[model samples]
Target: MMQSTTGELSLSWSQVAARRLVRHGLDTPAQGARPAEIVRALCGAHAQVVSAAFWSIGLRSASLTSTAVKDALWSEHSLIKTFGPRGTVHLLAAQDLPLWAGALSALPPSHNGQSQEVRLTPEQTDEVVKVIAAALSDTELTIDELSEAVIAATGSWAGELVMPAFNGMWPRWRMALAQAGICGALCFGPNRGSKVTYTNPRRFLPEFAPVEERRALTWLLKSYLSAYGPATPQHFAQWLNAPRSWAKELFNALSAELEPVKVNGSLAWVVAGDSTFPSSLPQSVRLLPYFDAYAVGGQPRELLFPGRATQRALTPSGQAGNYQVLLVDGIVAGVWHQRRSGRRLDITVEAFEQLSATQRRELDEQVERIGAFLNAQPCLTLGPVNVGAHA
Candidate 1:
């Protein structure tokens, strides 16, 4: 139980964790919820690894297979694959793109350190974005095709081999790809053969139009708080990779819509009328994939990554989601990995401490759930995970 402070609702770490698990749809599977609903609930699912993104959604949904998730993205057009929070690839609900696009496009510009020769000026960046948007409108194009179109639309300057990529130098104008996505100019199309493609988001939601920035930010802040609340402005700032000052200002501007409360002596905020947390502690066990939103978005880091999880589960800088996590009773209790061979999936788990029989049984059930999501036979191994982060 939480010790109460005068005139304010007080919460315990356990209560917060339990409430978060419920809000995240992990405590009890949101039975019959569509993939888009799951994605919308989490704000977005990290999709740098497409498979990881599927599992992140699958785990929270009842009996949803990865095929359903793919269908939502490729066939039904219920989800949009694009740059989301922190300028990373994510699977966002198609219906919410207006809000996300507006909020993200409103972010203050960030500095990406590159030599002046390699970097695009603000004007050049705008020009490249306009060209890219024009090139992609109502049509899908591979990166190579888009690159050719961009250089032709702009000039030889846009084609200069400057930005360093893993293989070699990339063309200069390619730097604006994510920015174009942020501005509602483009989104991912289904891959053609082995090549990735980009297209205009308007093809999916023809009525799509970015909501006004202030209104969009208000919606985003409320959604973030609803899913991962009792979080401070710094947490919100870090999650969005936005300026802390800007986040503070936004939080202050919306003070009347928010309620302040103390969680174990630390201050945080929740939606004004939604500050109550569940009284009972949760006992759910889950296998969360890399960059899972629940693992990455939850705040008051020390509480989520208690003791050994700090050393094992999180990156040295304390970033979560670099490694796949094992959750017991709504908190990280171990780490795990999966490898697939033919129709078989092998999972290895490394617990910070021995799990009770019930926890072990629940862990087995969780592994089975993963297998069902992937349509593979599963084998569980209990041992040290020799693999490193994001292996």
Candidate 2:
């Protein structure tokens, strides 16, 4: 469907959320969408905390077990965890890593523009990337081992390279390592103890071919729109950690493939041909994990939440970051956190509004499913936290 500048398809916020639930595979069981399909569908699952991504998949897929998620990453090589959009660790489809990496690598590192912040020297950055690429050529190394390798490779300079971050000194070599993760040279491996190990993506993707910048960005945006469509330029840029101007420029450049749509009376663009959703779709309840793309991807929180909903879910810094959201009828109706003790799991759900009996029943079933995915016996608690309701 095409919409002129003056004429656009109008959609209610509820309609958009319903479409997203369907698109993200939460509305119906996408039986075939394993970790790879599920992550790719959401433009990669936000995985700053890896366990969250595991649950993100289980919530979307009917049969994905905790072991299945790990197997897909380390054994089956179907998924790869790497730094994706916004320079955050995301679990992405291994087959699509090259394109994702190419597009992300094209964007300048977010730290470079930190004006008053002392950053890594360009020479030091280059040396660190080279060392990581060489040391991890066929081997996986935890951050400590990689730090040792960088120190050994670059001598004293590596040790002296440190930057101010989180009110403490962080190894400047980490910047290059992060950049390499964005550029596709490195990805996560199984954790050794409590430390994450890194290895070259070439271990499974030896046939990786470089993608042109525009082509890769185009591919990524289209996929993003497919899953998180009817999104504004600001939403795309914010999701990618790039400036809004870049998003606007890309939209203008790719206008032919774009279609305008109205989002709860506001304007947005979706890839052409996907601008419509059935007027009536399924109402669903889900437990979306921390940073699950579906909860964090789409925007204009005022529409996604009831009054003061964003205030209830935001961090201390006032960002609408999803830590484990409760989705009722595709809107963020509650928030949750989990604790695992051996084979026992405890989940606490903080509902913004009192759930109806039907919704409560669904919540119970969902919690049980989450426990099953983790191979644990689960106990549930539900209540409104102080911030859950502003009234």
Candidate 3:
């Protein structure tokens, strides 16, 4: 008998994808996992684009309706949309907001090196953060109203930054909004007619006490490995937008709980005892939305988006999400676009390689799944595809 001390497992990209897909609740029906579990698995969904957020969760939990996702954020108060990891708007479970806030707050302010034109001073930023929390405790207010409250609290200087912008003239306090969300001072409230609103996160998460900073962040790394494991500290650092040294510190602190694993000849870490792929795997085809967790969370993007898919999915600048992605046999195979008219949803696909007959049939089924998920008639336009184009 051979005793295994070093936890090293040889794994291929497909094997990783199979496990990751199931872990993300994409391999089964909606009942496969609850919304909170789904969000927890991928850390959180990139919800900067609300539609992408809906589809990200929609594609995973086929049974949950758009209305249900919104209800989860509003009526049920199960989901929270706020500025989370990487300093972007994300959707996470309300119960988990405190831990996210703790970890995010542990990092310094994001606007450290920003140009003075848009930067808020330390005192002004602190006042803005404090005012937002106080004004939103029980009442929901639009950004304008919140800005007013912040100005009242911090003086007119807080809103003095003026620039022609898409939304409106942004105030100096706007620069502190991301930090505010991270500090648990504010979370999205219901829409005030056409404007987005904010409220105290404690409204829905009153009992949510933030754990110790190190403990919460360490748990975050643990969860990161559960889904996107066999990934390097560099990957975790990039995902969280923290310093590489900071990430390494956290990994070092959690060394006892992580097992060494080899990913494409390089060393990475996975939570101990979970360094292998599943016993049985199912074939899969998926249409993932912009900044979808699967595409964002999976590591070794060079392997996940090989060859042609790489060029189109990622540009020379390295910015992704030029278009929606098409996943077949657990890899990104192409790109797609969709439009809606009345109750009908029209979709177009651009493939990187020649898809087989069975794959084509499966693509048709995907159309139906998306249709039911959106409560609309799905009409697909299929042809030989060239990855980046919308139609």
Candidate 4:
């Protein structure tokens, strides 16, 4: 019998995380992946990966074919459930959607510190879905058009509806439709001149077949642990917006296949039954997109930022500062910001505290690589912090 050890794992943490992120189309390498290769790998099939990746990698928005988004829908694997985590639209993968939907749905109306007056009724939801479905039966309908159709369907019932009274109702509609196996964004017409159109999942990809909900949930939980294990139940619960009981259940299911490791004096889970060292673990710098999971996934800032400095890096409003990070040795050593003028991209480094000569050199090399990644020439500027510095 063989035991699993961290060193035996053939891949480094950065490589595994990066590869998984890129494979899911959440992060695009400076060198892009081939479209055929991407399709073959089943990239973009998971909605959480897509949404979280989009935020993590700082993509303005993924320019996906409407069809790909649709394939994720209609298959019954994913759903757009209301009152889900963050009270926003998330393209949750099929398997995890039910658990998330169920957990969120079970919460009281005032959960997440939100008001209850804005909640939607089943009848009102049905009316909106019916009208929107009918109006968009043949073509893509924009947000305005969908809203109009929804309002029209209500007719005399419109004034009595809670959705119409609230501005946040659109996301509720989106969530409901997602639960029904419809996913994808409203297509914006060229020149921003035409009305938005609703792109149906069936119309986008004709091959999607609904999968069993239990299987989908199990697979999603497994993927979460595999990619982000060594995490605590609280962390998992937070990320999935699930209850402690639900998260515990899922986490226990994989206990036999996961090993516990100590990270910063705390227990974290890691994949079990594998023994291979990763090919390489290079020190690379990346400008993570806002809302990146590396920053959001775990509960405390110690994983990515120093505990003492977390307050300064993350504002009271929960927004990360403007500085691009220096990911030296897989730990955030300091912050960097770019100033672009004409063909020049000047990068300024702000060390967390102070750097040794060796650390400084490492930082420089990492910045150089970052320059190349951005397709710009590197001009390094080093100095002490100013009272109010602007990047």
Q: Which TM-score value belongs to model 1?
A: 0.97
Model 3: how far residue 302 lies from native, Å: 0.6
Candidate 3 clashes: the total is: 1
**RMSD (Å) per prediction:** 1.4, 3.0, 2.8, 7.8
TM-scores of all candidate predictions against the true structure: 0.97, 0.92, 0.92, 0.61
lDDT of 1 by residue, 248-284 (tens): 9999999999998888877889999997788898788
lDDT per residue (tens digit) for residues 270-363 in model 2: 8998776857757778987767787678677666666556667766454555456788888878788777889989888898888899989989
Ranking by lDDT: 1, 2, 3, 4
- Score residue 254 of candidate 1 by CA lDDT: 98
Best by TM-score: 1
- Off-target runs (Cα >4 Å) in candidate 4 are 1-114, 126-138, 155-198, 253-265, 271-282, 298-300, 317-324, 338-348, 355-391
Backbone N/Cα/C clashes per model: 0, 0, 1, 27
TM-score ranking from best to worst? 1, 3, 2, 4
Question: Which model is ahead, 1 or 4, in terms of TM-score?
Answer: 1
- Candidate 2 residues lying further than 4 Å off, grouped into runs, are 1-5, 112-117, 121-124, 165-168, 385-391
Error of 1 at 112 (Å): 2.0
**TM-score of candidate 3 on Cα atoms, chains taken together:** 0.92
**Which has the higher TM-score value, candidate number 1 or candidate number 3?**
1
User: What digit string (tens of lDDT, one per residue) describes model 3 on residues 163-229?
Assistant: 3358677777788888889888898887888899999888888776667898788778888888887
Model 2, position 331, has a per-residue lDDT of 83
lDDT of 4 by residue, 67-123 (tens): 333333333323321123434334444333334434444333323332455545667
